[model samples]
Target chain A: MKTLIKNAVCLIILLTAVIVNGSGQEYVKLERSRNLQLNNTSAGQEISINVTDEYNYLRIKVEGQFTMGSLLIELIDPSGNISRNFTIEAGGVNTSDIRADRAGAVSGQMQKAFRNPAEGYWQVRITPRKATGSLRIYSLQIYNPRTDLIELEQIEKDTDEHIG
Target chain B: MNISVRAPISKKSIAALVPFLLVSVSTSLAQHKITVDIETDTTIWAPVAYLSLIPDFNYLNTISYNHIIEQSGISKEGLYEFSTEYLPEEEHLYRVHFSKKGDPPASLILGGRDHNHFFLFAERNSNISVTVKSGNRFINDLIFQGYSPNKALQGINTMLEALDSIDQNGNIVNREYAIEAIYEDIKTYADTCSFPLPSLYALYNINYAKDYDNNPAFYRRYLHKWRSQKSLYFREFRSSIRGEIKPSWLIVIIAGSVMLSIILTMYLYSRLKKKNNKNPLSELTIQERKVFNLLKQGKSNKEIAEECSVSVSTIKSHVNSIYSKLDVRSRRDILDIEY
Candidate 1:
C-alpha cells in the first residue's frame, strides 16, 4: 500500500511540473499572449524578454489601456547585440537608438531575405517611464500564424486590469 | 602755313626733320572733344555744367570735383552744352556738376556708370543719363534729365570679380559653371524682380557673368524696365527672393524627399506585418487565447478545462466562442488550421 501511495504522489508532482512548463511552452507556439503588471514604476526600470532559437520569425506587439506612461522596447540578439526597437508614449521622447531604419522593423519578421534570419537568442528589453498600466505582450514566441492574413485581433482583456 | 626753322642747321636736315615731324603730328592728333549738356528737367538751367572723370568711381577726390581742372575744359557757361576733349579710352566714368556758381554742391549730384550701349538711348530718358558714343543731343531729352553713368562701374566691378574667380585661382578652380549659374540667376531676377536697383543689379549680373560668346544682349531687355516702382514692399520682396534659393534649396528638397520616403516605407511595412499577423483568434481575451492555444495543440475540451483552473462548462463555452471567431464548427476545424 505504501509503494502504491508513493507512486501516486510521484505521478502528481510530475504532472504538476509538466503542466507549468507546458503552459509556458505552448503559449509560445503562435500568437502567444502574456501579461506583465506595471505598478508605481519609477525610473531605471527595465524588463528583458529573451527569444530563443526555434521560432522562425520574430515579431512583438504591445497592447494595453494606458492612462499615463511611456515605454521604450529594444531587441537584443544572442550575440548580446541590440537588433530592433519601438516606443510607446503618452507623452515622452525617443532615444538615440540605432538609426538603421532601412531595416527599420524592430518587432517584425526577418527582413527582406525570407527564410533567413539571425538565428539565435533574441532578447527584448523594455524601459518604462512613469508607467502605471499593465502591458500585454501579444506574442511570446517566434510566430507563424496561419489565418492572420488580413487582421489582428485587439486583445479583449479585463478593462479594469489594463486601465491605469 | 610757312615753315621757318631757326638757322642752326642745314636746309636738307631741316627738310628731312620737317616731313618726319609733320607725319608724327598728324598721326598723334588729339581726340574729338566730349560735349555733355547738363540741364535740369524741371527748369533748363543756363546750359552750364562741368563734367569730370575719375579713374575709379569709389575713389572720389573731393578736391578735384567742380573745378576748372580738366585736360580739355568741359565747363557749362550759361548754356546746357559742356565740351571737353575726348578721352583716349573708348569708355569713361563721368560726374556732372552745374556750372552755375550758386548751384548745388557736386556732392549732391549722384552718379552711376551703368551706361552700356543702353545708355545711348538712356541719353534720351529722365534720370541721370550718359553716352559713350555720339548723339548726346539726340539723347532723348527725356533721358538726360537725370542719368547716372555710374551703373557700368558696378557691372564692371562684378565682371572683374567673375574674371578674378578664374584668374585669382590661377584657373585651378573652374568657374565657368558658377558663372553660368549666376547668369541664370540674373535672367530669373531680370524676369521677375520688381525693384529697380535689383533689376539693375540683375542687368549687371547678366552683363557681367554671361558668356557673351553665346549671347551678348541677353540682359538688354531687362534694362528698359528698370524703373523704380512706387511700392517699396513689392520692390523689397522681389529683390530679396533671388539669393534665397541656391543649391541649398535642392538639398532641402532631396533631404525632405528622402525623409518622406523612409517614413512612408516604415508605415507600409508595419501595416503589412500587422495584416500578416491578423487572426480572428487574436480577438480572443487573454484567457481565451490561453485556452485557444491549448485547444490548437490538439488538447481535448476536457484537458483544456482541467488545465485552466476553470470549470469544464466554462472551458466549453470558451471553445465554442473560439470556434465562432475562427469560422469553424468544432475543435477538429481548429486543429486543421495551417498554423
Candidate 2:
C-alpha cells in the first residue's frame, strides 16, 4: 500500500510539472457578457476597453436573437474616431470598412489587428432597434503565438465604469 | 560447497521500479532552467515569451522562432522561466522573444528589426538569469548573467547597436561608406575575438563574399585557427565557407594546369624539332637531288634522264641511292616521308 501511494505521488508530481511548464501565452484581460432589452426609445449600449500599445489585437463578438437591420455596432479608437461600424444584416453582419469579419450562423465575430495600437481607451457602441436578447463581448490581448485556455484571477464587474 | 545465486529481477520488482525511474528522468529533465524578470516601465512587451533554439550560428536566422523549444507565460510577479534538459551538451544560441498579441508566429515586427528579442548561450546543465529593463531598445534593456559566451555576444550586440544608431539618426554623410566601415569593425572583432561561437556570429553578420574577396588570407588563417574547435557553431562556420573555393587551392590548381599545358606543348615541339632535323635531301649530292625531284613529279627513269641530262642507267642508280638515303624502297615511299 505504501509503495502504491508513493508511485501515485511521483506520477502526479511529474504531470504537474509538465502542465505548469507549458502554460500561459495569450492573456484575456476583459470579458463581459450582457443581456439587454432595447426598444426604439432606449439608449445605445457602450462598452469600452483600455488598449495599450502593447496590445496587438482586439476582438468583438455579438450574438443572440435579434431582428435583421436592428443592431449596429461601432468601434471607436482612442482619438474618438469611428474605425469600424458593424450592422446586422440578413443572414450575416456587414462592416463599414474593416474586412476581418467572420460572422457565424448565430454569432458575429469581428477581429482587428493593430500595427501599433493607440495608448488609450477604445469604445464599442451597440445600438439596437426593438431588440431583446443576450449579447456577449470579450477582448483578448495577444502576447505571443502560443495559445493557452487559462483564465486569470482578479475579475471585476461593474455596470458602466469609464475605463482608460 | 553450496553457492546461492541471485535470480533475475522479478515482474513485481520491475513494476515497483517503474515510478522511481520516471521520477529520476523527470528530475533530470528539470535540471536546467532559464528565468527572466521583466522590469520594463512601458507595457510594450506581451505577457508571454518564447524560448527558441537556433540550429546554427547564422545571425540572420536568429530573427525567427522557427525552432521554438518552449513557451512560458510571465508570472504575476513578472518572472518567466523555461526549464528543460533537452538542450545539447555543447553551448548553442537561444533567443527569448517577447511579442505582443497578434504578432506573427515567427520573426519580429518591422521586418525583424524589432528589439523584443535577446539571445543567450546555454548548455543542458546551465542555469541562466536575465533582467529586461526600460531602455531605448530591447537589447539595451537586457542584462544577461551567468553565461560567459552570452556576455560576449551581448558585447557585440552593443557595438552593432551603436553602429546602427549612427545610420538611424542619419549622422554620417556617406551612408554606404559608413556601413562598410561598420562592417570592417565587425570583421575586426571576428578576427580578434577569443570565443569561437561569438566570433562566428560576428563574422556572419557582414558580407562574407566581399570580405573573402578583399582578403582571403584572413579567412584561411581564421579557418586554420578554429578548425579544431568542438563547437557546432565553428563547424557550421567552416562548412559555410567551404561553399567557396579556397583561394590558395585555386591558385595551385590554376598554376598546375598552366604548367601541364606548357610541358605538353614543349614535348610535342621537341618531337617536331627532332623530325625536322632529319632532312632526306641532306644525305644526297646535288645531281641526286635533281633526280629525286624529277622522280617525285611522276617522271619515270627515262624522263628523269632527260630532265637531269643523265643517262637512263644513271637515273636508275640515283633513284636507288635516293631510296636508300631516305629509308624507302619505292617512289611512293619517298612521297610518304614527312619533312
Candidate 3:
C-alpha cells in the first residue's frame, strides 16, 4: 500500500505541527501582579485578595484623572456577595469599555471568572458614587489557566506596558 | 363534542381540597403587608430579605434577580414580611435587599457599598412598615411607616445624601456651578413633592441620565406635570426619558448653527457679488460707456481722448475696457465706484 500512504502523510504533518506549536506557546500562571496607586477618596476604598485554591482569574485595571466623579467597582465574593460591579463615571462606563486617556481621564477594566473562585479573602470595593477621583491601578492580575489560554487581550497589553 | 374526562377524586373529593386551600392561603395573607424590621447580623447581614419589583428607574443597577418579587426569612425578632399579594395595583418600584447568605445564585444587592438596597413605593393595598435600624446605615437608618411614598422617599434620600456630601466636601467652588445649584434644589423637590410616587422618586434621585442634558425644560416640565399620572414609573418616564434630550452639545449647537448659516450665506453672497461687480459700467461698450464717463471725469487718457470722441489710442482702449469690466485696479480704482 505504497508505504502505508506515505506513513499517513507523514503522520498528518506531525500532527499539524504539534497543534500549531501548542497554540503558539500559550501560558498563564501569574498568580498575582500589582501596580496600584489608589485614592478615590470620599470615604471609599477596600481591596483585599487572597483567593487561593490556585487562582482562576480576576483582573481590575482602572486608570483615572477625573473631571468629575462617580466610581463604584465592586467584586466582593468569598461570600460577602457581589461578584462583579463597575461604574467609573463622569458620564460613562457603567458596564465596561471606557478608554479615554491622553489625559482626558477615563480607563476601565473589570473582570471575574472562576468556577471555583471562593477561597477565603477577596474584596476590591472602591466606592465613591460621585466625586473624589484618581484610581490608577493599572493591573491587579491574579491568573491561572495553562494548557493554552491567556488572552484578556494579551493580558491587557502586557499589563498596560508593564504599568505604562 | 369531544368531552372526555378522567376521575381520581374521592376521599370526599380529597376532603374538599383542604378548606379551599386554606381559603386561598388566607386571602393571600390578607392582600399585602410588607413588614421588615431587620437587624440581621448573621455574622454581617443575611437572614434573607429580597422583594424586588423594579421595572423602571432603569432597574436600579440590576446585576440580576430578574426582578425577584419575593423572599422573606428574617424572624428571630428581626421580623421580615413581604408576600405582597402579587404586587402591581399601580404604585410600583420596590426593592429591599440584604445579602451575604452565601450569595452565588443571582446575587446583586447594589446601592453602593454598604447601602445594600432600600427603595420603596409599593401598592397592591400596601400596608408597609420597614424599620431596619440595628447599627444604622441600612440606607441611612431606614424608617418608613406605611408608605406615603416611603416618606417622600426618605426626603429624597436625605436630599441625595446632602448632594453627595457637597460633592464629598470639596464644598463646591463651582463644582459645575454647585452641581447645577444642587440640581435646582432637587428640581424644586421634584416640583413640590406630594407624592406622584415621591415625585417619581425625586426624579430618580436626580441623575436622570446625567441631568437630562442639563435641564430639558425640567424634563419637559416633568413630562407635562406627570401627564395625568399613570404608573410603570410614569410610563418609563414617558418612554425612556423622552427622546434622549438631543445632547451632543445639542448636536454641536445645531451643527454650529448650520455651519454659521452656511458661512453666513457664503459671506453674504460674496458681498452681493462684490456689490454687483462694483459698477459693471452697465456691462460696458457704448464706447465703453463714453469711456467710463470720461474716466470718471478726472480725464487724462489724453483727456479721455478729448472728451470721448475716441482715439487717443481709442481712449487707451476705453481704459483697458473699464479695467477689465470693473474688477478695477486704477483710474484710482475707476474713481472709487459707488455704483
Error of 3 at B83 (Å): 11
How far off is residue B169 in model 2, in Å?
3.0
A best-first ranking of the candidates according to their lDDT comes to: 3, 2, 1
Tens digits of lDDT, candidate 2, B33-77: 888886543465556777878787544432322355677776877
The prediction achieving the highest TM-score against the true structure is 2
Best by lDDT: 3
Candidate 3 lDDT over A76-95, as tens digits, reads 76658554465544432222
Stretch of 10 with least lDDT, candidate 3 chain B: B104-113
Q: Per-residue lDDT tens digits of candidate 1, residues B1-339? A: 999877679888888899899988975673333334432332332233444443332222221222222322334342333333333223333444442222321212111111111221122112333432244332222223333434433343354345423322222234446545656655565567543433444444343322334543443344335434433323443344333323467788999999999999999999999987897666789988899789878887788888987899999899778877777897788788875
CAPRI verdict (incorrect, acceptable, medium, high) for model 2: incorrect
Q: What is the TM-score of chain B in candidate 3?
A: 0.32
Q: Candidate 2 — which residues are off by over 4 angstroms?
A: A1-164, B1-30, B39-47, B59-66, B75-77, B110-113, B134-140, B174-194, B206-225, B239-245, B248-261, B279-339
After superposition, the stretches of candidate 1 with alpha carbons farther than 4 Å from their true spots are A1-164, B1-76, B79-258, B271-290, B297-313, B323-330, B336-339
Error of 3 at B324 (Å): 14
What's model 2's lDDT at B260?
100
Clashes in candidate 1: how many?
29
Residue B72 in candidate 2, Cα distance off native in Å: 3.1
lDDT minimum window of 10 residues, candidate 1 chain B: B108-117
